[model samples]
Target: MHCYIVEYRAYAREHLDGRWPTYSRLVSLGKAIAPAGPVELWVLQSGARPGSDYTLLASKMTSTPIDAFDVLPVECPRDNVRETPPIDILITRYCSMNSKAELIALARRMVKRRPLGRLEFVGPAE
Candidate 1:
């Protein structure tokens, strides 16, 4: 896996909630973030280097997404029909913290710094 530092504009399209994405939408979004995978999605800013932030965000995975929830876990059998949630189902989800305000500020900063335009791919060099 590699680490990517992505600004909001480059990642805006991949932020899918529950809507079904059209093929063309997927194609365009895929092109925009060609080399970066979803390693770290920063909704808010710390103004720190991506190195410090990546560790903290990755820590979220240590706790399961369903922890403390009242929902029951079910197992699916191959012979039985797999069930899916209806499109209109209302399920609670978490958004990244202080995302709106941070994104707005980021846009302003990017205008001056072109920080959003910079995409860094750091890993074992080929």
Candidate 2:
């Protein structure tokens, strides 16, 4: 299975509903650029670091820690049939903090994994 690391910045504005289309586009890009393999989405919050962000986000979204999410240890017999890890494409939208360098560095660390571009942020109210 192939994994892609995506830089995400959550924000209060930006509608926050268009993420699905954006995610789909990135996945399509990956499929076109990379080999035909399973992809999984790994989202790292703007404030969270690389090693732990996946776990944190997963926990908040699924109520399960990253470590516990590992199927190898769970010993689920149906693991083989599970859908190809949903193209680990990171979809981070509305980040107000973090410099470009930090985001770039994080994106580079996972060169093997695809790095979808950062999500745009809507500025403060006028």
Candidate 3:
């Protein structure tokens, strides 16, 4: 399976109708990754205490175009340390994972050689 990870800060504001705000950059990234095949988009919440585990807010399978009105500006962390890249990939399907821990473990292994960034891809071993 191919996976793409993007960071989002949900604390900054309340999500409207439980939908995650998508950004222009995020949509572009999704387009770049969609050609490979079905992809899992892991939404990792930022601002967790250093050394603490990451919070997986949501997971979606993106392979659709997003409405213009649904797009929002890039989200910035509360500390203002850095700006999170905007991601607005339309969720075509919802991914049901066995457990959060399982998902995280897979993410950890995939990203071990390449640290997570704004938008990271974890494909089959090269």
Candidate 4:
């Protein structure tokens, strides 16, 4: 099945209600964009790297669309916070792949370009 990686940053891990804003947004966007495919959302925290220091906030499959609320356990303020950092969202799509090397290469290319608020497609390696 096709997979989409939705990358974004977050200042606060969780909202006042203990729900992850990024995860919520990811599921919403995924349903809107690729309602029939698997969607993975990655959230990068402050002072964190792209591929390494990121959290798999949430993911949804075509079959289990209702179970997309899965999120990492993160602590946050109970009261309203101020001066939160801005987060940029980027979406990258990977077609069916046969090997792990192709996935690694495509991820490297994505890290280099860091496309923002756009869709990128990486077909299977030839």
Candidate 5:
């Protein structure tokens, strides 16, 4: 089995009004997919706000190490209405961005990791 890492941000919705499922929700989603295995955490970073320009860091309990990440930017309809752009769910699964190397190195690393695997789908966040 392969491991995964995921991050989220709000694009379509405004920062104050936008929303993303909680960590527990993600765990439940993972568990539903792979009932018998363990889902480890490499790193989980949720910004203070959509564009608050701040990051909140938490320590992992065990660190089994996440091999890849699947980030989904969800844009749900308000009052059962959908707009243009059709709510993009850009799915990019790649390795963790190393903090030491700066932006250029990080992008390079992401490119190298991309061909390894990719998964994109339209579904509700657990």
Candidate 6:
């Protein structure tokens, strides 16, 4: 199966409740090849805030966009209502920047965008 990479903002109901996205490589020794499972990693945007800026990154199978993510629920206090579907995340790598243009550029490189393999819903890479 082809691997899909996507970048988007992920956040919790509140700033402090936020958790960094993460990645994991599923193991299947039964397979003839070792490490046959996919590798997941987050490509966060620079200067994005916890609950404001869009700085989250995700990757998964080439199915639906959500399939590309390893999401985790955002924990909150009892008074705070839990998010319905929760958020998809693993271990995320955060970049620091001053403008949205810079963030888009970095995201483009992370996904290895090609003329034939453009992202499903992200903005233009040019």
Every candidate's lDDT:
0.26, 0.28, 0.32, 0.33, 0.30, 0.34
The regions of model 6 sitting more than 4 angstroms off are 1-65, 70-94, 113-126
Candidate 3 deviates by what RMSD?
17.5
The CA-based lDDT of model 2 is what?
Answer: 0.28
Which sections of candidate 5 miss by over 4 Å?
A: 1-30, 34-46, 49-63, 80-126
The parts of candidate 1 lying over 4 Å away from their true place are: 1-97, 115-126
Q: Rank the candidates by lDDT, best first.
A: 6, 4, 3, 5, 2, 1
lDDT of 3 by residue, 5-122 (tens): 3333353334434555332122121211222233343434333344222322212354464221111112222332333454576433223335445454444334223222332233
Worst 10 residues of 1 by lDDT: 25-34
Q: In candidate 5, how many Å is residue 71 off?
A: 1.7
Better of 2 and 6 by TM-score: 6
Clashes of each: 0, 8, 4, 0, 2, 11
User: What digit string (tens of lDDT, one per residue) describes model 1 on residues 44-121?
Assistant: 232344322211111112234312111111222233333446558754332232344443333233223212223233
Best by TM-score: 6
Q: Residues 5-101, candidate 6: write the lDDT tens digits.
A: 2322344334533455333222211111112234343432233345433333434534444333332122222342334443466433333445555
Task: Estimate TM-scores for all models.
Answer: 0.17, 0.17, 0.21, 0.20, 0.21, 0.24
Q: Taking the tens digit of each residue's C-alpha lDDT, what string does model 4 give over 18-79?
A: 43323212222222112334345434332323323332243444464343333333322233
Worst 10 residues of 4 by lDDT: 24-33
Candidate 2 lDDT tens digits, 16-103? 5444321111211111111223323233332233323222111112334323211111121232223434445843332221444443
Predict model 1's lDDT versus the native.
Answer: 0.26
lDDT of residue 27 for candidate 1: 7
